[model samples]
Target: MSSAVLHRDTRFVPKKAIGGQGCYINLEDGTKFLDSTGGAAVSCLGHGNEKVNRMIKDQLDQLAYCHSAFFGTQVSEDLASFLTESTGGKLSKLFVVSSGSEAIEAALKLARQYFLELPTPQDQRTRFIARLPSYHGTTLGALGAGGHVLRRQPFEPLLAKNTSHVSPCYAYRGKKDRESDADYVARLATELDAEFQRVGPESVCAFIAEPVVGAALGCVPAVPGYFPAMKAVCERYGALFILDEIMSGMGRCGTLHAWEQEGVVPDIQTIGKGLGGGYAPVSGILINDSIVQAMDKGSGVFRHGQTYQGHPISCAAALAVQKTIKEDSLLENVRTMGAYLESQLRQTFENHPYVGDIRGKGLFWGVRITWAVWAETFTDLYMQLEFVKDRTTKEPFDPQDRLSFLIQEKGLQPEFAVSLYGSPGTVDGIRGDHVVLAPPYIVSKEEIDTIVNVMTRVLAEVFAELGV
Candidate 1:
């Protein structure tokens, strides 16, 4: 072994990625694995897509990069047009950036700028209210906007001030047993209203959230009427409503925008992940007509700008990704296969002692495990047979339990499925984990069946070893 310059984050060894294509990865050590989580849900079309690669090659042939301060490229403009066109006329403007975090930073800043169009000066704006356990981004500005306590703890002192947090519409955890959906929605709305009052509604520029709670909450959609209620409250205070669709948009959730599923729409939206399909790094903000009109009449130039705001190559790749989705009619596969996947998972894990929750929409799904849920017990099969048990099966903590580590040690590539979307809850960021499963949009129904079969067997095998 040779010494290399060391970086931080002890999560993984500094290994080289040898090759990857179509939901699989090859390590330099000759290990192969399925990328089910899609590289933190970024690779919607999978890796090494030929069309996307070809488009990048074509863009490089024309021009690779252009500083946004000087010229506006055609590729970027067309990509923006595609984004707005997909939104069905309401979202009319797009601003591109190189990453999701940048997109979020722009969204927050743009909301405040939109309010500046009012006679009130910028100094009058000082507050941002976001949902708890939601992750917006890593930059200080975006971090300040986010409410994931674990991610923000280290930089708490350095984060910008005047940011407040409110409850997320995570009905799975937040809703009381006796509470009806209507009552739950009303309660959350009241909480939001109370938060605005405390923060002084006029001082609040925006209320931000993920349409589908991504990493922090494990692919949870809000209860019915949640978004509409939230939107109504934001309108009452003249504050912008921002939806972070970075993890749930661009057909990953079987919709162009997850907000489309809700009765109401957001004033501004942040999208990435599925945008470039991992062919190129790109993210952006979609501003609604009202916000754009405000800026058009007030100060025209948005206060925020990035050096690589509209990278030609990234835009070209994203354009190809969008085109492939349209031509392939992949959203049909996503919806049909999503239902099939849900059925398959429910069947495989329904009687299992450890599976607490199997919930999500479209291709985005998660398997939540509680401390009381142990897979090995195989106890009371009849008791576990109910479709929606809503029972707690506390997971076993043997202190020696490390199932993923065992899988890695085995070096057996998953043929039926990519890697599991794994996480621990109630134990901070690292513990109390569960696995996530998000396959490619082009995934066949047979592929969905296979993923469930593999996970069923894998977990069973792991638990057998643990003697649960």
Candidate 2:
């Protein structure tokens, strides 16, 4: 058989997903796989949700699409109101887009436009500061503002030159032993301040970061007081503080917003994935009242436009998704199940020889694989186990092994039948491997048990096959 569609990996064809229901997906060959990662943590509400389906159908009957330039749809307006109100009026405006990448593009443009719309028009502000090993999106603007190493490598020349990178607040491999969290935070803050000073603080436009880093760092959250301190540094330079919650927000981290747990509000926040629970292609940016006021008082319009910016069907679906989350009180379940999942993971793998770190919040979790061994010299044992030769050093596996991808492939076998989001380059941008598990909010205890059990077997098999 042949395929016409150009897949992400041109060399291989993927299995056909014929249908999805609840927490599982059915392939054309009759194999059912547990969708533990929810297709990159997008399907928060699970699949085959009748309530959301009905809403989309109803919206199609009423209206499907509308250009934002001429008229606005009620569904779009309602979705915006729902989002803004959810923030308790902290973010007074919303700019709808079709994907996380689009949302990031919009946020970047809005932040730049905001400075231009200010009373004095700080046109000198041009640069953006973002953390390394971060994933924002694939678009050039978003890629420029992000620090994902491999993603930016091919298109380095095309990316915007106004952005710079800084070290992430990664406590696992970053925080020194015996270093207090406060001291680590202070050091990060100092580093940020130095970057600003080096880049000329007056020329900086914003400092963008993920509330909880997504694929690049594999669900790494900043230590307590990290966000506040970083935000304070941004304030010192009068630059906007932008949070990319594309993978960690919208109840994915046990709260409606990941920042709710961090005790800081970003000047601009981009959200996606779970925003519409994968029912529709939708993402958006929430803007602070100050930025909205500046734009409203000046240009009176954002200098950006997309043909499908506020598609009615997308908004209707998103509205239903948000309504269901609130009406069903699913956030409570997220907290409960998240805790259960955490306990289960720790109990199962806390002492595993190959598992290096297990970190996450809410439903999003990452298990990093590192084979640490105490040996006098490199020998057969070292050749057999490739991951971090020494755990104390927190070293990473060779990128050539593709260990995470191997685990992902093993998990998809009928014997395992589980889908885990596996990624590499966790340590720097090209040297580590980890697998993320983000089941739908509707996942039950039994389902979680199955996920863990399957992962346990899959990992054991992988290690045994490697003769580690």
Candidate 3:
């Protein structure tokens, strides 16, 4: 059969998914694959959750759509209130949007408008600073703010020039040998400060970063004190602090908000993926009181609107998802299950030759693959040289090999029957490969064991086929 739909990769049409239940996805061919990565970490509640389904159905019966400029829906307002209250008023307002990218676009625009509405109107603040090797979103404004090299490459000329990059707080690669966590954090803070100065501190709008980097860096969590230091730098420059939690927040990291563990609250936060538990396309931005107050006093308007900004069905789905998490105590399960998953991963692959680093928080984990073994004694420059030499050193696989994608393909086979989230460009923006595991929060110990077991066989098979 010829398909008219344009798929992500035009070269190959993907297998059709017929249904999903809990942690497994059923294909049209009758194969059931374990969904260990939650479909890009979006299906936090897994699939076919009855409560969320019922909520959406109910909302459909009531009101399905409402244009933000003309009318307001109770579901939208309720969802916003739930989110802001979940933050304990630290983030005082919410702006509903349809996807993570749209959430980021809203954040960027709001940040710019926030400054414009200030008493003195710092309109000169047009620049945004984000970390390298981070994924924000695909929209033009969001892409410009993100630092993922490959994603931004083709659109480089079209992207806004207002955004600049800085080195991420990647302990595995960025930290020098024998550097204490404090010194490492200080170095990053100094670098951020320098970037602000270089870009004219007074002209910068915000310094945006993901609390736990996803996709581009492969689930890298910053070392302790990292965010606090970075936030301090932003505060020093009077620039807003924006945290992109599209992949790592909404209880994905064993907390309602990933920043809760970092000891810093962002002035503006973008959330998505798990927000609606895959039942609906939904995402939003959490704005702090100061920014909300500024707009309230100045323009009393956000200066932005989308036809589906507060779509009723999407809000209902998200509201139900959040309520389920709280009532069912899924976060407790996440913490317990996350610990078990971490231990299992370490026990299985801590010494595996192809595996270089294991990193993550909660159920969000990444197994970084490398051809070379890493040692604590190696200097930063020495490591770089080793990577250049490829095999027999702690270097990333060649980009052409597509090791991560191959592993993912293998996981879907009947022999493996697991859906692993494999990604490339983990080292720089195009060199390294890694597989992320973000099973549903409702996942069980038995399911975790199955995921690890399948991954073990899948990796060995792929590497052996490559003769590595």
Query: How well does each candidate superpose onto the true structure, as a TM-score?
Result: 0.89, 0.96, 0.96
Off by over 4 Å in 3: 372-392
Model 2 C-alpha lDDT per residue in residues 1-468, reported as the tens digit of each score: 678989999888899999999999999989998999989999999999999999999999987876788999999889999999999899998888999999999998898999999989999998999989898999998888888888999999998899998899988778887999999999999999999999999999999999878888777878889999999999999999999998899988888888988999999999999999999999999999999899989999898999999889889888999999999988888888887887787778767777777778888887777754222110000001123534666567778877888898999888898987888888788888888888898889999999989988998887777666
What tens-digit string does per-residue lDDT give for candidate 1 at 1-468? Answer: 444546553454555678887767787766666666676777888777888888899999999998999999999889988889998888999999989999998988888778788555555776899987778999999888887777888999999987888888866556787999899999999999999999798889889998777777667778789999999999998888999999888887777678888877788899998888888899998989998887888878888887788899989988999999999888877787777777776777756666666667778876665433222111100011111122463432432365434432322443433467554332333444456677788767666666667777777676677675
Off by over 4 Å in 1: 2-15, 120-122, 371-390, 393-417, 426-431, 461-467
Candidate 2: residue 130 Cα off by (Å): 0.2
TM-score of 3: 0.96
Steric clash pairs (candidate 3): 372-393, 372-394
Candidate 2 wrong stretches, greater than 4 Å: 372-389
Compared with the true structure, all predictions reach lDDT values of 0.74, 0.85, 0.86
* CA error at residue 409 for candidate 2, angstroms: 1.1
Total clashes for model 2: 0
Tell me how far the alpha carbon of residue 264 in candidate 1 is from the true structure, in angstroms, after superposition.
Answer: 1.6
lDDT of 3 by residue, 104-132 (tens): 99999999999999999999999999989
